[model samples]
Target: MIYDLLIVGGGVNGCAIARDAAGRGLRVLLVEQTDLAAATSSASTKLIHGGLRYLEQYEFRLVHEALAERELLLAAAPHIIRPLQFILPHEPSVRPAWLVRLGLYLYDHLARRKRIPGSRAVTLAGSAFGAPLAGAYRLGFSYYDCRVDDTRLVVLEAIDARERGAELRIGAKLVGARRDGDVWRASISGADGRIESVGARALVNASGPWVQETLTQRLDLRSTKHVRLVKGSHIVTRRLYAGDHAYLLQRPDKRIVFAIPFETDFTLIGTTDVPFSGAPGPVAIDAEETDYLLDSIRHFFRVEIGRGDVVWSYSGLRPLFDDGALKASVVTRDYAFDLARAEGAPALSVFGGKITTARRLAEHALETLAPFFPRLGPAWTAQATLPGGDLGPGGFDAFLAEVTRAKPFLPPSLARRLAGAYGTRLWRFLEQARSMDDLGEDHGCGLTEAELAFLRAEEWARSAEDVLWRRSKLGLRLDGAQQARLGRCF
Candidate 1:
């Protein structure tokens, strides 16, 4: 069978494209060399945002589109993606008070905000948001974005694509491909060390950081544009504050840092923008980046944070479109595509993109290749929901109540975590379990055989890291021995 589209990479953009194209009745095959969301997608700041900081860079269109997508994504995946209020403590030194208000005003009115509330000023004194802040901070502003289980978003997109008849091959690397008349002859090396040849009408390179490498090395195509590699790193520490709201900290250098709640027991702080020239692979936070994050947070939060306080740290590279900005932070977060259809068998290479607008990016991608496939279906993902996203008319809170009532045998904590991770879909696996014993071998935390089996059979989770780290952030709770046992099960 000749697939209508062949995609490379399993990051958010790739999965989103597969989901969109497959839903449009196009036979699609998405091949990822590693696990879904194993790279930059999972290492994000974990916020589905319009990038308020981008306003300073004068990226109005990017911010507007992202803000619009923000509301749509929240509706599509209510369980994993929900509204988050952000508190930006004013540092008069950073910008004049009028400028801050003006920026906030524009952020509120740039796009039509439906579920997310408008931005407003807040007093830092004697308020919950100000409790952990330094004495110097007296005023702040609050606006809503969202928090998401980033990895699960990618997995859900891939799952949706598969359900729509898209073939997703994890642990499969594209050895190379050549344009043969009208279709692409692609060689893929599977996990079992077997090579399979397939034909596709068109090819898409959504290889996030590997976009350039895939085009040049595998397809033997020279890219008309270049992607600037920038490294962004994050650190996990014990909860820094007492509210559900996240803090946006300002640095003397004018860069911003976020301190948000994570996994119910930790604070997620991050993202240093340093130009990266090294080959894209496993990246870790360096001593300098660590110091920078700690120092930036310390200026606002009264608590003293050091290297010892970091429980877990991760780093990922952003393959942003080269916009010739002197600073990495100033580069545009928007996406672009280079279509090589003039040469035969339309080959589209994706450039810079962020999680906030990956769905829109996918829509535009299909639109770019529409001429080749005249019978392509119209765009439909905008009104559709991803797997397990429909929480009924009552939304997540009511859905949680319903699960709790139905599963009286489940521990409250376990029930809440399962509902948050899988939403209404947890019933598929939990329906047979009557009590704690029914869950089978405890892999530590609340993870049990029932959930593990579901992940392995359904979610493409191949190892403990996929289950503990990406599927759910229980790695923070598991010990070394427990992790090893869980890995062996997979």
Candidate 2:
């Protein structure tokens, strides 16, 4: 079948575009070389934020659009997207308190924020939100942003795309493409190493870190601009703070690091920006980056954390648009598209996008392709709910209550976690599980064989890493032996 649109990458931007296009009555096909979001999407800071630092660069338009989309996404997928509060400690060495307040003031008023609370000042000594910080810091600011299950967001988009009549192919890499008159003929190699050909009226390359590689090497397309590869890494450790709020610590070098409350019992601290020339996939946090993160954490927190405290660490390469920026930390997180059309064929390549801006990027991408798909349906994804996101605007607590009533035998923590991850779709998993025995053996932290099967059947989970690292946070709870057992089971 000749698809109306063919999307390459299967990351957030690609999956989002596929969902939007398919929902708009276009026949779409999306191909991924690896598991969905196995790249930059899953390796994000995992926040649906407005890029608070972008305000310094006068990126008000990007920040406003992202902030508006934050509320829309929260309403659309309350299961995976929810509001999170962050504490920013005041440092005399950094920006003045007045300047910080002014920037946050602009940030709060920039977006059409309906559900999230605005920023407020707090005394670090007496406020509950500042108990985790060092005693030297006595003043701080608290603000709101949304947290997301970045990987599941991508999977849900792919699921929504499939539900909307789009063909979704995983582990299928785009090997070659050529313009054939009014259409583009693309060749994709599946996981089994078998190549398949497909024709499309238009093509989109949303390959995050591999954008330039896909265009230059795979598709033989050339561009004057290139992407600068910047690596950001995160470390997970046992929870150090007492409260539910996260922290945004400012380093003396003018960089900010996030110390977020993670997974009930742990804290997620990260992300140092450094130039990288290594491969995109299999990116690992090196000793230098680990030490840098630890130093940053130690600088602000009363609790000291060394390498011994780290239980897990991960790294991802950001495909930033190279504009000769010398400092990796200053590189812009905004995105741009290169639309190429040679008479009858068209291909649009995307570069430098974040999880927060994916939906808007899709809308703009479709707008770019409107000339080719002249008769395609109008844009409609802004208000559409992703798969498993049809929670009827009910608050999370209300949704949890409904799940608890349906599965009385389920432990409160497990039920809440499942409901948070799967939303109303938890019903499907609980339909056959009447008792705790029906949940299968506990693999620690509520992970069970039944849950694994559900993920495999519904969430396109093919490997243990896909389940542990992406689909859920079971990786932090499970040890090496347990991971190996899960791998064998898969």
Per-residue lDDT of model 2, residues 1-490, tens digit only: 6888889988899999999898888999999888999988888888999989989888889899899999999988999998999999998788999999999999999987899999999888866776667656788999999989999899898888888899988888899988889898999899899988999988898988888888888778998778899989999999988888899988888889999988889989989898988766668899999999899888888797899999989888889988677898888888888988866789999988889989989999999888777687898988888777887756788889988988898889899899889987777777788898898987777887788888988888999999999999888888889888889877
> What does the lDDT come to for candidate 2?
0.88
Measured against the true structure, the TM-scores of the candidates, in listed sequence, are 0.99, 0.97
- What local lDDT score does residue 85 receive in model 1, on the 0 to 100 scale? 90
Q: Which ranges in model 1 have alpha carbons more than 4 Å from their true place?
A: none
Compared with the true structure, the alpha-carbon lDDT of candidate 1 equals: 0.92
What's model 2's lDDT at 359? Answer: 91
